[model samples]
Target: MNKLLKTISVSVLGAAMLSPVLSTVVFAATAASEQQATRNLVQQLSNIKSFSANFEQTTKATAGTKPAQRTGLSAQHMNQTFVGEMKVERPGKFYWETKTPAKQTIVTSGKTVWIYDPDLQQAVRQTLDDQVANTPALLLSGNTAQIMQAYRVAQPDQSKTYYRLYPRVKDSAFQSLTISFGTNKAPNMMVLLDSLGQTTSIRFNNVKVNPSIPASVFNFTPPKGTDIINQ
Candidate 1:
């Protein structure tokens, strides 16, 4: 569940729209040109009110990293591919579901978050607090200025417009994040490198921008016999 949450946080961060506040303080180490480029990219996505897409996610351990012995799984088992669907509405509402390898659902109603695992008949509920708000998923849409301050942005590929971000904070969940946009300026793919040397890539398909997503999509009710954990 922890691993899943981390993946969702990074993936959703790439998919969510940035807030409209254009004045942001970039890292002092970043060049002025790169900062402006990053701001332009943010402005391009600020108009999106909602986003929905089908995604294919692949996670693999980087070479030289040993497989997780705690889980008693081989390197191949640790490397996985999943197909999922995601929906996001402005002001903090989202739904993410993984359909393959296992079925898991995560939904947030702007105030409360629910994570459900059908196979285990368990659900975890959490309140939206300051700590949670700082996560990549929420930060992307919550405050553009703050997110810019938190990460150093760079456009490594001028021709491809690849926006790469490195967290300035020490406790960041992932080491770095890279997002690639389609011709229409919609995010087509995102790659996340975690501290454990695991690389997770999510490719988006059939993306719908500013779609009329129903509010009910962000609401979740645990089924009967499910064990509920609150935090």
Candidate 2:
């Protein structure tokens, strides 16, 4: 799942983890126009009623005992918050859905956060408390100012705005985060780096700036004959 994040971030920074990781895909920008353009983009984002995008996520790490990283796709919706279906592996095997507002319900499968598998019928619910770990949630829930608190905001090139951020807590799980905005001025891509020096990168495409989506997408109803796990 950690590796999956790196891939999805290529498209959506709407994920909010504790230390913070997010960004829009690269858009051309000029040094003279950086601050204003960014401000305009933020303002535009704040006014958006809905959004939909596709993400390509990728991850990498040093070879050896360290975990070998890979990537995948995350189809997403950014309303007041973020909700999406993503497969961490192929054939859409591992799918994670996000629902927001409650922050509590963002990753829920039922009243419980983890879904019960009828085959196993056993699911354990664990609160991934460290917001840094819930990058997707924060990315969709927060604004630019909130993100700036922990990251050193940088505009790397005339066409690219980047953010280099780290966790505020010394013991936070991640080492750093990088977010990139598109030259056209959209918050579209992000990259996360963990303490192990592993990196995950995500990109967004086919975006809908402000469109309508089904409310049911954010609601969770447990499957039939499944045990509700609360832990």
Supply the global lDDT for candidate 2: 0.43
Worst 10-residue lDDT window for candidate 1 reads: 8-17
lDDT of 2 by residue, 1-231 (tens): 232332222222233334335554544434424355446445544554445555554445525523333222122321122334332211111234433221112233122234433345444454434353335424443444555454433343433355445556676556666566554445477676666554565666765554555545434555666566654
Query: Model 1: residues >4 Å from true position, as ranges?
Result: 8-32, 68-77, 137-141
CA lDDT, every model vs. true structure: 0.70, 0.43
TM-score of each: 0.80, 0.55
lDDT of 1 at 41: 58
lDDT of 1 by residue, 94-155 (tens): 78799998888988878988889999999999997756655544443455666677778776
